[model samples]
Target: MNRAFHRILIANRGEIAVRLIRAARELGLETIAVHADVDRAALHVLEADRAVSIGPAPAAESYLSIPAVLEAARASGAEAIHPGYGFLSENADFAQGVIDAGLVWIGPPPEAMRLLGDKLGAKALATKLGIPTVPGDDSERDRVDRSAEPKDQEKADAALIRKAKGVGFPLLLKAVAGGGGKGMRRVDRESELPEAIRSARREGHAAFGDSRLLVERFVSPAHHVEIQLFADAHGHVVHLGERECSIQRRHQKIVEESPSPTIDPAVREMMADAAVTLARAAGYRSAGTCEFLLDEQGRFYFLEVNTRLQVEHPVTEMVTGMDLARMQMVEATGKDLSRGQSVVEWRGHAIECRLYAEDPERGFLPSSGPVLMFKAPEGPGVRVDSGIMAGWHVGIHYDPILAKIIVHDHTRERAVARMQRALAETVVLGLTTNLGFLQVVVRHPEFVAGRTPIDFLDRHLRDWKAHESPPGAEVLALAAMAEWERLGMIGSGSGPSVVANGGSGADGDGSSPWRQLGPFRLGERRR
Candidate 1:
């Protein structure tokens, strides 16, 4: 039986949507992209077979609106909805809404998502399955649940404080329904616990619509590793491999690579088994990632499960040679795993660097503006997945990620070098970007040796900045020169092509054939 749909609606924006479009087209399926007003000219919208305007620029009025996305899918006659990564990708209610609308949800079952989406519920399941989880106060888990009460709130606060003290100082207050570091806070002392909890809860509610939080012992100098899992309704599950996402800033990963340089084969197998066990226990289907915090002592604990395609899925695909997005489409339509775990193999090392519209010099604040020039790196062992182009406006209403550059090679060393070379070749002018900072990180000594932990950036490159100066006179002059040559200003002759001053080539009578009535000029004056 063919377990594939004829058309799928990508219910997200940016590069991930572009990724899904290409994959769906390769599988002979029509792709539909839903975008906000600001994304009307986005590359993903242009690439898709069909596009629908969802709502305004703000995500709340657009991408995160379930009704709007469903309406777009209906209008496009899409048979399935693939929530590419962020927005409502891991949203259980959104999954249910899609299913209720009689459209296939191209992700894990809604119930599975609901179960594992709650940090406490997932931790309980992991404990039941004998998977090691971060030690914390599980006894008062129910009492600290999200609820409304001034009197009850005071009691809950005291209980939370007790739990935090027990968990020890330097703990993380993590939102139960959060990912991408949205609702997370790090408290280094007991005095900061109350404020941290209040802020984390507020952000969690605003970001995820769920304010429930959990306190866990912060594992410093730990490696952030996660195993990619694929399961189908036919009771088959397999682990592709693991990605080391330790290079991060503000709890968000900026660089990720496959075949962690830190973990040995023994620990790898153990973690893989643990991931599969948790997946099966939760009745997981479709693509999911089991995250784990690996301590310096080689001990690992279950962190959380991301119930959608990861942002770094390219690294896994590069090394394993698997089309995870296509596999997701097929599985959502009710299919079994293509192969067993025994057949799944990994060949080489792959690294992915996320390029964002931000100024690394100014505290990594998001930058938004028109992309005056755009060029992607091209070569063997290099891939660029982007959703922007020259003249496109990058809006501040969404994730700052502009593109992802992935490189693969026979070894990690070669892969890092390839990425460095690729970054140098790439260009995105007219806006501030973290391109230079990424190049520095990949070439740094600790990164080259794969000695990265969660605090790699903070510990090593706290003052990281672009070595090259911002675009200025030289850059504008070069741009002008390129434009002039393109406009036939230069030729084989030693003299100018048409006129002495490289002007509009006025005739002897000063009647220039190329002169326009307006004041607009075409070429630069000859030096």
Candidate 2:
């Protein structure tokens, strides 16, 4: 039975919340935005039709609190809740709670979420369905989960070490219930195994509330590919295409592109088929992603399923011309998909780069402060999905990602060039960012040749530094003058203010000093 809803509540914040709000508005559905105390003035809150304060600054008390989010939904008169990508997006208990509250949950069923959310269970199902998975020791997962006392923990560790020896020296210690690279560690030698297990368990427990761990053979020099999947309640499932996400730091993807540059037609078909098959077997619904690792020999192994919308979904949308957020809402209403696999088409190439408040030179540590200026690039095939504007505060309470820049073109080479141009034109002042580092990665010869592997950063840019020369004395002086004018330290008649392109600082006459200065990297000037 199809159920229609007039309003939906977005249970997350940041760029994804803003994205969902836009998608819902296009469907003529009212949107309610929930936020923490610090996010009262956030972009998503400002854009939403109605806003509710869930709790304080910490995610656990706000976005992750089922009671707070559900109360907000009820108070806002929302008929459905959309958990976009992170927070409680993958939590089965949260999904169940939404259903118990008599509100529509725009995601997979709780049973399916539980089945696929556990890496061990997902792998077991894939193996049963004849889908290839990475070779690892699955025998000791239960022991690790049950071990609590000192003696039992020691035995479990010994058993894990013995099993790991069979898996080989180089393997990954991963949390059974983990995502976003949390609860993951790479062990290259036996001496690093014990501490790695303890560390992974501690981190995993802190992140996902589960301390169980799994060991898998580390596949190096491999490409991280994921298939975008959509399923409905009517037993229909289709895969959009594959996205290559090999460029990562700390196991979290930073750059993604559709129509993987190195994947051949045959392998694409095979992977797509496997992903659809897995989705069907799990009775999955809404937007999900099946991740895999493809080696040089062309052999691929299933990794896990992300049971929610992905951060890099824009690349898939750009290539496939599909609105995934809208599709999820439609599916939640018990509606069948209008298109099938045969009619679905993928055109051209699309690339996405995440803009984060982090310093790449400083081990990618989170950077936070006020956004003084923000100018997204504009041109053909360029799309900027942002959640911050000038005067917005970047805080440490949440993920540091501020925006995503997606570009599309007829070919991968052209898309790469367009991304480079977009990055160059992007302006984010008042904080350290990875914009310059992203520029270097895209321009690297190996990246240009599409030779990116899982360890691309560790192998090529382990000692990366900001090579750009600081702003010249004249540019610095101009910047100082602009700051003084902004702070009202100088009188309005003293001088004209300098502003980036598309900003309002220029006079109404459309002529400004910035126009004559030509191009300069305003963000490159360290604060």
Candidate 3:
């Protein structure tokens, strides 16, 4: 066992680093934080016992630089490294390098990372293990550039047409190694296939640096469900139930909930079983996630496996009452997980929404600026896992995520209500954020009732956007403090005022930050 390891280095930044620190502290281990120039003042760095400056602000010069991180770990005397969900978290070479540096790698072995980090490899391995997978394109089709079809082009044209017909129309072009909806396209007609393939290849190259693309059948309204599993080097594996992440935009999940409203007990058990089978086949050790797609008929198909921690690990911790990060560290140290699949008990409903600094109205584009003020929500059932606080600068160098607001309750209905209220109380005024949009989603009748499909937002999102309302007395009151700095007070507080603090400004006419710019303020307050 790694009982001798006294200190660990958290090799990432933001909320995930904070998350790892919390877990490490609880396990009676000191932690180290590595930060880039921009993240030097980040919360994770402040919370860790030791902090090290790795490199410049750009990710390539900082977080993605392996030798720099290892050097920091070695210099800090950290016995092991915990890669929390991004950057080198899934980098197989980095994991092996950590091992080669004589530092404990608090994650799956490098071999297992190879099996799961690559989309094509993971799917092929899953299928060989008899795990039913979605019909994803796993092959790189060498395009016979028709431009190179030669002067005898008529025969080549016939051959091209034959290949197109064989592959069928309405195909999905995807990167052989891609995630987060990158390098993906839905082609609804044959005429769009070649162009779609080219665009997908271009994007794949830009994102993963490899342009290999494949085509698969498009599946609509598919639910994105994943099983969180844990294993030790002893070969004991356990599934920690499934998380419903269907409420997404642009193919990325913004809101995720445990005990999926769509899955029944039988389906949950079956899905969990399938995940365990896949993990066993991989000989995976440590915490990992098995992603899948549920069709209209409720058939589950393996998508790919995330061999490291997930951004939404907190939600699973809420339902399963297990500290996933701590378990990962322990398992990496050769300690067996206490709760096996048979003993893993899920309690209550847990829901999480990612808080991103973005303009939802503008395709969720990333927003960056100084967070002059930042206020996160807090309530009986609400938990906010955030990276930045007031006075922290927000940068576009990394993901736009600000925090993850999660709520836990005994029932799904309560959980929805809790999330709605939590979003309402969340205020981030100085920068644009998805807070207002998140509130609308949380309160939508379809979402509250859990009658949502994959494309629920694609259709109903407009309904929420079209209908703009003036902030009520409460919203004005909450936003009044920040507005007080801009516009003068409305009137005396003897009785009632226009907006909160009697702030003198346009009322329901849409001049308020709450209405005009949406709920995305750089550092708006919510009490």
Best of the candidates, lDDT: 2
What is candidate 3's TM-score against the reference? Answer: 0.85
| Total backbone collisions for each predicted model | 0, 0, 15
Give per-model CA RMSD: 7.9, 3.5, 7.1
Candidate 3 lDDT tens digits, 270-385:
88888898788878999899888888888888787888888888899999888888888888778655665678889999999999998887788899886644556666988888
Clash pairs of candidate 2?
none
Regions more than 4 Å wrong, model 3: 1-3, 141-169, 462-527
Q: How many backbone clashes does candidate 3 have?
A: 15
Model 3, residue 156: distance off in Å is 16
Give the higher-TM-score candidate: 2 or 3.
2
Tens digit per residue, CA lDDT, model 2, 130-247? 9999999776455545322334677777888999999996899888889999999999999999899888878887778887778899998899999999989888899999999999
Model 2 ranges off by over 4 Å: 143-151, 472-527
User: RMSD to the native, candidate 2?
Assistant: 3.5
Which structure among the candidates has the greatest TM-score? 2
Model 1 ranges with Cα > 4 A deviation = 1-4, 138-152, 471-527
lDDT tens digits, residue span 1-527, model 1: 34457989999998999999999999899989988998997888888988999999999999999999999999999999999898999899999999899888999999999999878889999999999999876543465455323246666667889988989978888888889998899999999977887788788877888767788999988999999999999899999999999998778999999999999889999999999999999999989999999998999999999999999999999999999999998888787666798898799899999999987778888988877555677789999888887568888999899999999999998998999889876766567788878888988999998899999989999986444333344545565345446446656442232221233322222322212121111112322
In candidate 2, residue 8 scores what lDDT?
Answer: 97
Candidate closer to the true structure by lDDT (higher is better), 1 or 2: 2
